[model samples]
Target: MIADSEIELHASRLMVMQAAWKHERGEDIRHESSICKVFVAEAVNRIIDRAVQMCGALGVSADTPLEHFYREARAFRIYDGPSEVHRMVIARDVLRSGNRS
Candidate 1:
């Protein structure tokens, strides 16, 4: 599970980097960046949640490092523009694109 989560995290980072590279080249990638950040944050949150749950009550208790991990997992949803905001951005982008075709 750890290995799989690590792979997912890495993939998300790669996607964000790729989108940034395209933006640097003058591509209209505002939506891409938003989507990438949302996905990456959500993925990392899921991984951290799993790690915490696997540790049992220690996950939320202040006696263990899992508590800190749990805090970070909960924060990820709000730190990067929030999941709902990103979803809205993606939907708007898709709708605008469709109208142009």
Candidate 2:
């Protein structure tokens, strides 16, 4: 699970960076932005959780870096915009595109 989450998070970061560069070059990348946001937001939590699970008691300890990551990842889900909203936006865009084609 940890490996999968790491892979997913990396992919999301790459997507976001690419989108940002595209926007800097005067391209519209709203869909990529939302997709990356949702992907990273969800994957970060999963990675932390898997790490926590692997660490056992130490994972939940107040002094551990894993715990801090866990908290941050959980809170990140709600920052800027929630995962639910981003997913909805992506779904709506997909539906619109499907209808067009």
Candidate of highest TM-score: 2
* Model 2 ranges with Cα > 4 A deviation: 99-101
TM-score of each: 0.78, 0.83
Candidate with best lDDT: 2
Clash count, predicted structure 1: 0
Q: Write the per-residue lDDT of candidate 1 for residues 1-101, one digit (tens) a residue.
A: 78878888899989988898988999888778787878888898888777777778877788887778767677777876888998898888889888521
lDDT of 1: 0.81
Per residue, candidate 2 scores C-alpha lDDT tens digits across 1-101 of 76787688788878889988989999878888888788888878888898899889989998579998887779888987998999898899989898511
The residue pairs that clash in candidate 2, if any, are none
Please list the C-alpha lDDT of all candidates, in the order they appear.
Answer: 0.81, 0.83
Cα error of candidate 2 at position 47, Å: 0.5
